[model samples]
Target: MLIFKNLGEMASLEYLYKYDMYFAIFQLTFIALLGYIILSWLFRMWKQYKQLKNDKASAELALLKSKIDPHFFFNTLNNLYGLAIKKSDEAPQVILKLSEIMRYTIYEGENETVLLKDEINYLEQYIEVHKIRYKKTVNITFTKVIEEENISVAPLLFIMLLENAFKHGVESLTNNAYINLELIVKKKTLIFSVENNFEVKENAQTGIGIENLKRRLQLIYPKKHELLIHKDTSVYKTQLTIQLK
Candidate 1:
């Protein structure tokens, strides 16, 4: 009877030890599983955070570009009205040209990018109107070295610089000031250079348009473009180069 009791006790103790070992393993496994779940949730949250940040950036960029369009449209319309009031006889033809530009500015300008041909045509019409406005005082030349007509570019980019050249370049001309515009496309790069001769007084200020233009460029192209402005003696020069992807 004693021997039987001792064997029974030893067996019970051994069973307890095995049960304890199993319980310890279960606890460790539960802890490890919980830690894995927590780490997985954190990783998912990080991904979501990055995605939201990118979305917000994209939204902000779209809003900024939207703001720029209205400012540009308002300015162009004001200029057109001034021309119409001054030159009533040519107002009809000017209205036609203005309509084309308005169509493009309203519809196409809202897009992220536009066909290069459309931009070229829009600029041509704008220059034609300017020619009518300042016929005798302003001399304008446009040169292009593009091999293809189906290229795409960011909208209203070059026009901003062109408009600035007209606004600030010719106001100080004594005889006849000239604006030379050039566009060159080679491989994957598009280059624009505008040179204007002007008389500079002591105090000269570049207005909101230029600043707004710079902001637009930064938002759209980021690191894909370069803009250079130089004033030497009596001439002002602006050069812009952008890589088209």
Candidate 2:
């Protein structure tokens, strides 16, 4: 039986090697190899495209975060310097708060997302640091209504809005300026609002911080978020909403 099988295989090979069958064999092999090459190339191209898109997003996020972390820290340093110049007694407290803020900046800032409680604590630290720096009472308040526990959010997401509040709102007025922040968390929604009263400027343009925040939101949250801004002669308001699971 083995001898018969060997004889049949050889006969089939001999028929295939016949001169008249050469073109047919070549054509079949060519088509099969071409199909394989085309499939391989398409797969490679698809993989590269996916990789490139992911890398681009990662790099842009890193760049936006870099822009943010330094901007606020440097401004805080300036406040510290001001206190140092005046030899203010609260300088020590400010220094301690700033150190804690720096610790968060160095460690937690690198994470893609963090606990909602931790994020709120980070914001409070910023507020406390500024409160220590301010010479007069600026009337700052933070109100929250969260129905969820152990929520997670993108880190450093709201600091730019807070920074903008302080820069354009709190700093422009001589007195009677106020900054109000509100946070609401539902089962699948998060809303954060910042409102402040400021002296109107002659022709103030939007700053880089807000623009940076906008871009970051586009990258991180995409269609899952909303940023609303309203400004008038006396008040500037920003509300950000994110749909989270």
Candidate 3:
């Protein structure tokens, strides 16, 4: 009878061992499936994140380009209108300059980056257009010290600042108005500043140009740029520094 009980005990132990083995295999399979599901979910999320980032960047770039084009054209047309009304002798020259500006904007402005020299030439042309309009009444001085002419930068980066200087500073002033602009490049960094004198109007509006500029800088340069603006009773100053990649 004792031998029979021992045989039954052994048989029970063997059955338990087989059951544990099956359970272990099932647990391992479940764990592997869970891990695979988690990994697939993570991959999908990462792909979605990348797609959203790309879409946002494209949208911002398009919006920036649109804003720049309209702003520039409106200002230039306004200047042309003034010249046309006066029937000035420089009207033809202004038209030619406008054509050149339009051509530059059409070709180079669409580019993601343009040569610093080309951008400077565009600025010179823009300034020349305004100089003809303001004539000797407003004193405008532009100085550039470029250590590297082959440097490339975003197109129309400085035009807004220059436009603001003219719009708020010299445009409304009756006499003795002045605008000073300087661009300095040193050791992979570009420093630009614009200072102007203006009479404070009671209900003056600082337009959207500065905001647009700030957004563009944030997108393109991220942590590699600095912008400073100072205003007082008589003078308004803007300074921007960009670290080139």
Candidate 4:
């Protein structure tokens, strides 16, 4: 206002030349203020864009994780149904194990992470449930060496690999089938591997489980984890290493 008043008081156009310094100062100040406002607005928009992208990613990951529960329960219930039809003595124990697994899936699966110990227990229960279904036709072995008990891992991460192992390796085998799994944790790294004998058929199509697991791993672990799968003749093997830190 003071600058404007000074300019207004100068009646002659020639007098305006003497106020060139004030005019230059005012013009620079206005441009600086305008630039600041525009930059601030752009920054705010960029921040919101990143947040929305993250939210969408999180939502998609949650949906994928949710699919695992129903798929697992469906298979488990089918096993129970088979046992019930046969009136097998292991039916009751299978039911109990299923109940425990369901409890973990319903409660702990909702969490982003669970204690490594709890996850291992869940896997043991899952393997036990499968063993009851397979009986003497299949041999399953699980070994683990844990250097730390207090570690945390994403829920349901390893289960898909185990599921794939049983589905492709032991489910259709009539006799002499075996699955061996090992888990080793050293410092901040965890290594899980599963190997099993499978009878490969002509034109066997892959299932959605592996793709789903890959997508989940990409979203959760990104570059922090490694998954390797190999098949040779009748043997299929997979190994996954995750960086816990």
Candidate 2 lDDT for residue 239? 98
Off by over 4 Å in 2: 1-33, 69-75, 82-88, 203-205
Winner on lDDT between 1 and 2 is 2
Tell me model 2's lDDT, rounded to 2 decimals: 0.88
lDDT of 2 by residue, 1-245 (tens): 99999999999889878955888888999999999999999999999999999899899888888787355677778988888999989788889888988888778988999999999998999999877767778999999999989999998888889988988888788899899999999878999999999987788755788888889899889999999999887998999999996
Better of 2 and 4 by lDDT: 2
Task: Write the number of the candidate with greater TM-score, choosing between 1 and 3.
Answer: 3
Question: Which residue pairs collide in model 4, if any?
Answer: none
Each candidate structure's TM-score, on Cα atoms with residue i matched to residue i, is 0.75, 0.82, 0.83, 0.85
Task: List model 3 lDDT by residue over 1-245, tens digit each.
Answer: 89989999999999999999999999999999999999999999999999999789878876886676355567778878888999978889989998988898778877889999998889899888878766558788889999876899998899889989988888768999999999999999999999999999988987888898999898888999999999999999999999998
Question: Which window of 10 residues has the lowest lDDT sum in candidate 3?
Answer: 65-74
Candidate 4 wrongly placed segments (more than 4 Å): 1-18, 69-72, 85-89
- How many clashes show up per model? 0, 0, 0, 0
lDDT of 4 at 185: 98
User: lDDT tens digits, residues 180-211, model 4?
Assistant: 99999998999999999988877766677778
The number of residue pairs in model 3 that clash at the backbone is: 0
- How far off is model 4, as Cα RMSD? 5.1
- Candidate 1 lDDT, 1-245, residue by residue in tens: 99999999999999999999999999999999999999999999999999997788668656555544343345556666886778767767767887887788778877878999889899999888766555467888999999766899878888877877777777567568899999999988999999998777677776666666677678778899899999888788889999888
CA error at residue 231 for candidate 4, angstroms: 0.9
